[model samples]
Target: MVFFKYPEQIRRVMYTTNTIEAIHRQFHKLTKTKVRFSKQNNLLKLLYVGIKNASTKWTMPFPNWNLAVSQLAICFEELLDATLDL
Candidate 1:
C-alpha cells in the first residue's frame, strides 16, 4: 500500500484521525462540565455548537497541502485521469 511507503510527514497528512481526535476532545471538553442532558435535542444542539466553534478554527490550510496533493496525483495519475474523464 502507498500508505506504508509514504514518509512520516506525508503519513501524518494522509492520516486524519488526529484532526478527528481533536474535534472529539473539543466536544468532550464542552460536555464534561454537564453531568446530563435534559433531552436528546439539547445534546444535539450542544454538539452542533461545538462543531461550529471547531470549524471556525480550521480557516488555515494544512501545511504542505499543495505538495501533498501533487504527490497523491502523481501516485494515482491514471485513476485521477479516469475520474476526470467521467
Candidate 2:
C-alpha cells in the first residue's frame, strides 16, 4: 500500500485522526450542556472559548515530528517548494 511505503513515524502521523475527533467531541460537550443561546454570537463565543481551551492541551509536540517532516520533505519536495514560493 502507498501508506506503508513511508517510514513508520510518517505513517503514525497520517493515521492519527483522533485529534480532530477529540476537538469535535469537546465542542459537542461544551455546546450540549447549554441548550439555549440568546444570540448566534453567543454560540460562536462559546466555540471560540472551547478552541482556546483545547489549544492549551495541545502544547506537546507530535511524536517523531522531525522524522515525519523529513520524510514529507523528501516525498513532496516540489510541492513544498511551490507552497514556500507563494
Candidate that would win on TM-score: 2
Report the lDDT tens digits of candidate 1 across residue range 1-86: 96789756567676864778988999999999999998999999999999999989878877877676666667677776677552
Q: Global CA lDDT of candidate 1, please?
A: 0.80
Residues 1-86, model 2: lDDT tens digits:
99899878778888984688879988998998788999999999999999999989888778777777778778888887677552
The deviation in Å at residue 2 for candidate 1 is: 7.4
Candidate 2 similarity to native, TM-score? 0.76
Candidate 2 structure lDDT: 0.84
In candidate 1, stretches whose alpha carbon ends up further than 4 angstroms from where it belongs are: 1-3, 15-17, 78-86
lDDT of 2 at 76: 82
Structure candidate 2, residue pairs in collision: none
Q: After superposition, how far is residue 48 of candidate 2 from its true place, in Å?
A: 0.5
